[model samples]
Target: MKVLLKGTSLLLLILAGTVMGCKSPENASNFPKRPNILFAIADDQSFPHAGAYGFAEIKTPAFDKVAKDGVLFNNAFVAAPQCSPSRAAILTGKNIWQLEEAGTHASSFPKKLNVFTDMLEDAGYQLGYTGKAWGPGNWKIAGWDRNPVGPAYNEKELTTVPSTGINKRDYFGNFSHFLEKRATGKPFFFWYGGHEPHRVYEPGSGAKAGKRFKNVQLPGFLPDDSVTRNDVIDYAFEIEYFDAHLLKMLKLLEEKGELANTVVVVTADNGMPFPYAKANLQEYGTHVPLAISWPDQIKSSKKVDDLVSMIDLAPTFLEIAGIKSAPVMTGQSIVPVLFSKGGENTSKRNYVLTGRERHTHARPDNLGYPARAIRTKEYLYVKNYKPERWPVGDPVPPNDENNKRAQTEGFKTLFPGYHDIDGSPSKTFMMKHQHEESVNRLFKNAFEKRPEAQLFDIQNDPECLYDLSGNTEYSDICADLRNKLDQELTKQGDPRMFGSDIFDSYPRYSPMRNFQGFNARGQYNPAYAD
Candidate 1:
């Protein structure tokens, strides 16, 4: 009798592991003993961008090879659209809402929540990380000795980079150093977090590198112009740069005779850093690419269409290690789907839940654009708690008073207006051409206010160009989805259901600026203090 644990205690999880009938992964013999786990995460990349997904603009040979050798997931999503919360969810195997401070961007991680890394370490797996890990937030305040992912291995540095914005962390070199330092004969779990395709990309780098303007595909929400095309192409260039390092790392593993035994999971933290994509609860925001290769266990040439979440990764890792997941985890392991010899959609999940709290210091008083969503194969339903607020951010620039205060307080980055939307060439173009008739709608779609309830038929409108929530024809579908979302959120104890402002109460550890008394002029008001 397989028992599905939900909202159970840690004691129960431990007891179940030792119990005769309830032994963890009752069929543990199916998996090879102690396979190495190689988790490679790109910073801000969306779905269908990699070569495996048939997007020619971005070339990711390593990701494509992993997909060809193992499973290519068509419907993989992050727990939150923002990086911090999304990474927190991936580490904890729980929804962002379940984590208090960690649910918001640049907030301190609570010490009570245990990460899978510690569990894996306890299980005698050698652990380490290179490049970016579970942060942009401070882990020290929570008394963590190191990053939640594990000890760092970022001493290696690259002498030169293709672009000005790309990090010179020497990711592959650092991974080689990590392998050299690890204990002999022990299975390793490594995190290769690549900070690429995020923002501040080199201008015309893609076109200069022989990428054509005609090949670039713009999303429906963005303007179809030279600026947008150039910006997207530049983003693709960075992704390829990240992939090059991944290819080198894979080769290193293969040379060491560990590629076949290593469970290589390649994915992104969130979507592309474009307006209506990164921080928003839209399709491109939460949806990301995923490819996992484990030649010793998983079957090759399989494309899985089942819905999977970043939160599910932790439990999946634990299950593969023959250890039970922590009871606090709300996410179910995808081991069944990973090891399945069946058709594409073998998993039982009908939908995936995604939400966001604070992303950047975009709104006044560090308040986040609170929203939750339920995504199914055909439709996506979103419930925005604060519909009156700007979805992207305040259109107005920061007041001189706030700017001066930030400088006086010694903050690194200035309060750039609309901070939630990453500062990029595309964003600059939209702001400059907001008055043009063709660009006006696109700007509004990205920068303006949104409705409380939004429903999109993803099958037909994958770009989410139309909302069916107000359409009388889809009233029943909308109602049913809303009820389902509400029920699940309530079960998961989402505080927003009862009109609680708990997410806002969490202390933001990052830089902050105040925008007071501007909402009357169609901007932010200083109602809540940061």
Candidate 2:
């Protein structure tokens, strides 16, 4: 009886040890088991707008929290100033120039190119996206039956609202649904693309909501007036709205007990939609805000000043998911900077590059004005391949008699009417001063016919107000940047850098030409002549 009792006691002790071993904390810092990824992208947002980035007028509590908890990169940029190309680069981890079809705006993406989402899904992770995804273009050719992100929502689900009269589809409700449907014990990837702060802002919305124009700081390139101030305020309102949705999404994640394990990255597709900002390769055009948070992994808040591009995002996402990247991906993973115990490295890239193809339907034969640029920490060198073409589409007089009459009567109107059209006070101011000597000088300074090469000192002139390309003092800087750009172009396999003879060898893809209005009948409208 004593021997039997002792054996029973030993069995109980072994069972207790096994139970305790199962309860031990999972060492998630190692490989194989990956954390979930949540990438939230905003449309047409600029740098320094969120409170985390130092914008006092706008309240972005969620973004600020992410920055406060993790890492905020001060020098993050996009490969292209436009949406399609930038998004393509982020997904494929390839340079825009290398993704020929995907390189152009509204162009059809080829099926041959592999996306990070596909790799992640293949690696046993559930992948989906809510709201805007790869494009305003067709993804069918890319073998996607539905949106690359996922399936669309029902009509009733789509028509709901967060606040009274405000669309809920534009917020986190859809994102919440996406998270709920994700399978248990499996990781998920979601892309929350918010279509806020793009354009056609509600007039007086900011002032009505108690936002004061007096607190607004005018950019040097824009005219300082009530009209411009009000325009800026409207922009602020939309940015705040976007932030509100982000806050709700964060709450949802927390409630699900997944906040600690999930990696959240917040950023924008490109710069603002203002003139000379969006669709241009300037600092204000390509520079964007980036904030990342991972409570279970990243323990402290920090700021990194390395020159990181949107293209790096794909590789970083793949690295975090423990997926191997393809050799074609030119972008390097930023995981080392985020997860390393040592201090973050800011000496990664010596320069960043961007370019623009087509913007609006302004040129004849649906031609686009091509320009490429290289931006260093202190200097920006641009090469305008086509100088004679109008940087902004060619001017087209108002077709409607009432619109023409309004312009004649001194009311404001944006010309060409192809891209943006609004009767604003700034438009009136621009019209009044369109031909004045001082205004002409400013216009020349901002946008004018340029030589093949242009350079600017960004430190002294943040708005790119002056061109120091001709200045002898900075001649060495220009030569150095030019040589660096040439080397990079060669490395990237761009035919343009090789010679004009090889330009024809590279396949040509039209940038948003069909969507902008290139007639399929091949007929020309002489009335729209420049």
Candidate 3:
């Protein structure tokens, strides 16, 4: 190798071939050989929402540039649709069912589940994150000395956000701080988890931020009223705000001459926080946008159509960093596809499994709506374990008088108890227009109790409006997909399949509200109603 440095010590080390080959303390690959990593995750955004995906309402130049420079995955998914478990799967490379308490939303995380961030830190990589690393759950209870995602870097704050809904944290400023504090010559890893486009947006903020309601696209399940359209625009505005911070961070990397070598991955934890999305395990819920850039190795401006999961992220990082992935990780690395013929359907993956347990403490007895699913290129099969229970929880608690539980605990449940979908103008409009026949699909698709199994031809009906589970024409296809989903769940040892109570046993760490449940015959079930 040519001696690129002028110092005598550098010349001596290069002349001594043995010294040139000597490994770092972490038994790491050469520091320059391993690229600096920046993983940015947006909270509560979904697929087909970014500008790179051709949505004009949302401006995401930073995410689009990453796609322009490297690979954009069209079929990427998360292990679970909710936040904590989805993020856990991304960091640990395992499904939520495989993780104990970490699997449940707002539940205590068990100490046994190790994460990739700690692995990178142990490998002598400076690791840190800003804004929403991991959850409504308490990680401290799991015996973690710090947040499992990384050490926090959210000390820096902004005077105000663009709107009332936008987060005030200085995401790029904190990332810059992380870079400034990093060890010299050491490859660094930073997680920029942006809390944007989630909920509680300033009313009409999207219109205020130059978003056009006419440009908004409404899913088949959502009513296309003016209120809903305006809400969608507001969501777009927050997404753009998140993208703006990402652009600044990317510019910093380019200014520092680290853009080409640094690996950049941009994605979201789950679907948009709207009715029939986010908490539900439909196509709109699990199918999220993913874009990656590793300019040093992969060619520019290509797209991949293979089925992939966020769980694949940890393994991919380990693979690219020249480190062996732990055996416990179930996800496969995308490195092979990145180095191969970059064409649609050229990737080896055929199917990606996704599922969920509890999301919020929204039901009576703190019960959860459990579901599992498998998505193939042609179809999506969903298996709901509890069909008897309300999927999104009861729309309203029982009307009661002089009942302390109803008075004190009915705050979140009194108006609309389907606590899974976020409360917003879209949701409120849908609920208000439930009586209208044309707009009632939103209510039926989102709030109604469902069958034990559902089959949707994702090729033709990505909206999942037509359920083919009972149709004779699709029986064989449904059977094959159901079998595959069960087989994977069995292999992963999911408690929902085996009827384990460990999921319900994990105590919720977030705020609780007691709810009254009705009997099968419509009478209040006093056992829980009190």
The C-alpha stretches of model 3 lying farther than 4 A from their native spots are: 1-32, 344-347, 397-413, 517-530
Candidate 1 residue runs with Cα over 4 Å from true position: 1-30, 342-344, 397-416, 517-530
Candidate 2 per-residue lDDT, tens place, 243-316, comes to 88889989888998888888899998888776557777777788898998988889998888777888888777
Q: What is the TM-score of each candidate against the true structure?
A: 0.91, 0.83, 0.90
User: RMSD in angstroms, all models?
Assistant: 5.8, 14.9, 11.2
Q: What are the per-residue Cα lDDT tens digits for candidate 1 across 205-272?
A: 88887888778777888899888898889899999998999999899999999999999999999999
What is the model-wide C-alpha lDDT for candidate 1? 0.82
Better of 1 and 3 by lDDT: 1
- For lDDT, the strongest prediction is 1
lDDT string, candidate 3, 6-91, tens digits: 34433332343212121222222333588889999999888988989988778899999999998888899999999999998888
User: Which stretch of 10 consecutive residues in model 3 shows the poorest summed lDDT?
Assistant: 521-530
At residue 404, give the lDDT of candidate 3.
44
State each model's CA lDDT, in order.
Answer: 0.82, 0.67, 0.79
